[model samples]
Target: MSLEGLNMLWQLVAAVFAGLGAAGVGLILRQLSGKRLPRWIVPALGGLGMIGYQIHYEYAWFDYKQAQLPASAEVVSTETDRMFWRPWTYIVPLTTGFTVLDQSNLVTQEAGEDRLVEFILYRFERQHTDMVSHQTYLLNCDAREMVPLSGDNREPRYAELRHVEGSTPLFQAVCPNA
Candidate 1:
């Protein structure tokens, strides 16, 4: 299995242990105090702790990936959103999605007399159900501008051309050939 798959498996195992540990503590407390604690309370507290840990892990996922990335890899942009089930997400925003670019793949291409940096875009999502998408682009090295190309047609599409800005770090890194 891939490293990511292993990481996910470990996270789940840790969560189970955390839940069990919390439940054990609750049982011990009840016995020491000689109080008439409900049996359901231990499992309930464990369930709550497990859910909290899962939320924290999900929210910090971006940072975890970043930490695993190589020095040459950088996060270009990020997208955040909230879900109805995760109400606390509104306060501590979760990185629901993001784009990353590795400078190692930078390439130079000639567009007639002009030299352009061409690279691929890698989009990442927090949800396992979603798949990463790759799109191609060409950057004018001197102008610090870029235009997206159609993956199927292998041609430039004018609809998404723009200047290099703080939001375009992925372009800056992957298209450094320009």
Candidate 2:
């Protein structure tokens, strides 16, 4: 199984345990009150606990993954969204994904007036199953342009080439002197 599969399985297991613990607390409360509390309170509390755990996990996932990255990885950008289904996000947007640039993998080349830097960009997204994807890119420091490179020959995809702003973290990280 993939790491994402294992993580999902662990989440399910943890949610079940949370429900069970909350139900146990409800039972204790009932007992302490001489059974005056309604029996429905036990299941209600269990459901609440399961939902609470899921919400906490979703909100904390970004920070948890960020902490696990190596020092060489720099977060270039983050994606946040507010979905209608996730109404709480309207109050505070949820971080659904992020892009990272690995400084350790950067390869710089100087040819006359042009300074070219090659690096890999890693993208991580949260979904039903967490997804991670990477692509190699070539950047021109002087022109502030970036293009994705193809396999083996490192052919640049001019169709996808785009100008990068100097103020962006990606540009700043790759072309510090520029």
Q: Which candidate achieves the best TM-score against the true structure?
A: 2
lDDT of 1 by residue, 1-178 (tens): 9877887899899899889988888888878778688788789879987887888888778887778777866778899987778888888778988887766676787778777877776888877644578777888866677898885766888788888852356645654444
Model 1 earns a TM-score of: 0.75
Pairs of residues clashing in candidate 2: none
Angstrom error of the Cα, residue 130, model 1: value is 5.8
Backbone clash count, each prediction separately = 0, 0
Angstrom error at residue 44, model 2? 1.2
lDDT of 2 by residue, 1-178 (tens): 9887898899999999999999999999999999999999899999989988988999998999899999999999999999998788999899999999999999999978999999999999998988899999999999999999998999999999999999999999999999
Over 4 Å off, model 2: 1-3
